[model samples]
Target: MSPRSGPPLDGAIDVHAHYVTPRLRAAMVDAGHAEPDGMPAIPDWSPESALADMDSLGVATALLSVSSPGVHFGSDADARRLARDVNTEGAEIAAARPDRFGLLASLPLPDVTGALAEVEHAFDALGADGITLHTHYDGKHLGHPEHEPLLSALDERAAVVVLHPTSPPCWEAVSAGLPRPLLEFPFETTRAVASLVLSGALERHPRIRFVVPHAGAALPVLADRIAAFSLISGGPPIDVAGALRGLHYDLAGFALPRQLPALLALADPDRLLYGSDLPFTPAPVARGLAEALAADATLTAEQQRSMRRGAAEALFPRFARPGPPGAAEPRPDDRSLRGDQR
Candidate 1:
């Protein structure tokens, strides 16, 4: 762990906040899908309003990425165009307020070539902090051979890739009127992590730092089961627990007594980072969750502090409060860090 950059660095660094630009919102509305992926009505968001909420809630910075039902809404050409537009705008937002914003450039995945090209531009030209990827593109999850080249490229650069759960193509519909995110989102996250572990993608692409969303979804509860099956099957000697431990996790959704304890058992507690999942979870819910965490007896002040800012500061120190706070200046290598948080 890196040294703590104290005091003014006390504010939380939200790695999971989503940005819904006017154009992106309009595109969703035009798709004949007002409730994309069953997320109620799309919540409103703007950088100014987000910053106000951040200030009110003690958030120092909120790294932005497109939320559920990512930009690749069935047309490769449109996906590519939307990706470029979204990323360019996001990068500009981060550049405009480097201290309070960070960009995780959206890539047009399921189209490897376009994703690769965008990755190059995001880092080289836009100076984006990292890339965000969905658990599965089309029907292929992250571990599928189709994504190996892209993962390999990210590994070569030691990029921080954040994985958000998108409803998999094969998911069955539940009849209870429950939203997809109510259960499917977390399951999809587990499915992707399981895919990565079973197929050895996590092991092969060792340098790529993955950030798992929703407190690693169902990963903690399923850890032992995944391990026993993989090891006993006599496959490619998988270390499921080790793989889970190596990846980072965010406190999105509700990281309380249940999720937090399970997460700590699986990985270093220091790996925990703060996430608001704002706009989708909305500011009010986000605020309530934050207050709950602060009052949770299961976590210590030290532990909570780490979740808020300390751990994230170490993970992506480039965003550490700069100038007057006595926090260290971001080193040359700091730009390489990226993480997934929703």
Candidate 2:
């Protein structure tokens, strides 16, 4: 394929981006969770700032999701309310600029009914492109039976579910009290995926198109080991390799030459996507990561292009297309899903 006007992936879609809503950030600070999950402070974010970053980074569209320590904070009612607020605000952003933005609506997970309600409101009312979920809710991993109802609903709809990681209850304490994002988050993602595979969630929810973040977490590097563990543990006769092949993976944090090879071993061109993890990872760092990915000798020009552009285009076709008739300037208040927003 020929190159686009700007960078290598001129119109690439960044699927693993995080959005720090004003309300959520304020709440965190108020609750003395200014360092939520042990991060120094919550990152400041605005739609305008994100759009600018996307332009400079050569990203066409960013599928925004609430990052770690998600919407929930103890009370189920509080979780439901915050989730709705976040999803509504996010929908407003995407509605304002459908071409440049896509909503991966956050759910109040571990509360199946609340999650189901948000799913309906997100897809049916807000016109969200997909839903984002943490690897665990409270302390329950994705594979837990409690999550099956939500998973089943997503499966029935053939939903595009983006699985992000959160440090679960078991990991409250860490070495040197290092930030959860530094080391635990990646492994948490791996732990959740393993739970899904071994618990037969992948097999049962075959149609739920899961987009795994952090280069399939530690899965690519540890897929075989996990499979062996499963066999030795006498888990449900699972097709460990085949199960992994079905999910999509985004290259964000760990796309080094050594890491890319393992991902390539597990997935083909179409299953790869570009992710910035912006704000959390500053634009300069994102640029460096992109540069490194481009310089990786192990990946071919075609495969790199696929990870950068082709795969994302196939996933979000509207962004890949030229601006539709009468595209308007994006505003924080604008809420036009297709024609109008209620």
Q: In model 1, what lDDT does residue 141 have?
A: 86
lDDT of 1 at 236: 69
Q: In model 2, which regions exceed 4 Å deviation?
A: 1-8, 322-342
What is the Å distance of residue 30 in model 2 from its true position?
2.8
Q: Candidate 1 — which residues are off by over 4 angstroms?
A: 1-9, 322-342
lDDT, residue 30, candidate 2 = 71
- Please give each candidate's TM-score: 0.89, 0.90
Question: Which run of 10 residues does model 1 get worst, by summed lDDT?
Answer: 1-10
**For residues 166-185, could you state the per-residue lDDT of candidate 2 as single tens digits?**
87676656635788887888
Q: Model 2 scores what on Cα lDDT?
A: 0.80
